[model samples]
Target: MRIAKEIRDDRTVLSIQEDRIDAHNSGELKNLVLKTLEGGAQNLVIDLARVQFIDSSGLGALLSGYKNANLRSSGFALAGLQPRVRSMFELTRLHRVFDIYPSLQLALSA
Candidate 1:
């Protein structure tokens, strides 16, 4: 898994560069999120624009990361999900659990 990080405004944008996020690499993804949070960002915006696939393990990683962020009085959100990825969240009812933005720009503005 390839992950990129940037600070947009005051939010940390963690962009993922992979089509599949599963048991094969969910731990790496989670670690990247932790590193971003440790970088002094309170608002976490995970940019999933390039991700086209995800499985249970990936979803679990996201939820765990969000929970960790929330523990610090911060929170994690998502942006730029493809239709297939979006559908998965909706199917699992996680779409309601997370704040989904149309793009990273909008997420940053929020």
Candidate 2:
């Protein structure tokens, strides 16, 4: 659950440093996302380029973030997903529910 946080173009970008997001660390990730939003980030982007794997817990964590952001009228997005991770989202039909981008740059611009 090591994450590199930065503010870029008025958006808080959280780059997950780990390759896997599973039950072990999904809680940390969820907590981080909630804290970032509570800290007053108007927009948040999760950079998942390095994450090659994710489980249901991971997806649930992200969905929680998304819901929280919506409640606060903030934006939540996912960027730079690896192929396997992307497929998991697709298979679960969560991809259509999230604002996903191909790259961090594109996400920031949007």
Candidate 3:
């Protein structure tokens, strides 16, 4: 999955370095996000700027992360979604479930 993590301004920023998040890597992604949450990152911003493709498993992983964060009364937001990836969320109506931003700066500010 090639995930990277950084903490800035009291928030955790998890960035996916891979081009795709699919069944093959979704589990890894989910586990990492959960671990980050367990590490006490209440404000999380997942940067998908490098991700150009995603599938159902990817969506599930994101939702799972969101649920986990919410359980802790934390924040979870997605940033830098490409148009195609954005469309998938819209098609699945996940756009309503997630707080998405067009840029990392916007996500962080939000």
lDDT-superior candidate, 1 or 3: 3
Give candidate 2's error at residue 93 in angstroms. Answer: 0.8
Of 2 and 3, which scores higher on lDDT? 2
Better of 1 and 3 by TM-score: 3
lDDT of each: 0.88, 0.96, 0.94
Off by over 4 Å in 1: none
- Would you estimate the TM-scores of all the predictions? 0.93, 0.98, 0.97
lDDT of 1 by residue, 77-102 (tens): 99999998999999999999998998
Model 2 misplaced stretches (Cα beyond 4 Å): none
How many clashing residue pairs, candidate 3? 0
Instruction: Please provide, for model 2 over 1-110, each residue's C-alpha lDDT reduced to its tens digit, 9 standing for 90 to 100.
Output: 79999999789999999999999999999999999999999999999999999999999999999999999999999999989999999999999999999999999888
Per-residue lDDT over 13-89 for candidate 3, one digit per residue giving the tens place of the 0 to 100 score: 99999999999999999999999999999899999999999999999999999999999999999999998899999
Candidate 1, lDDT over the whole model:
0.88
- Steric clash count of candidate 1: 0
Where is model 2 poorest over a 10-residue stretch in terms of lDDT? 1-10
TM-score, cand. 3 vs. native: 0.97
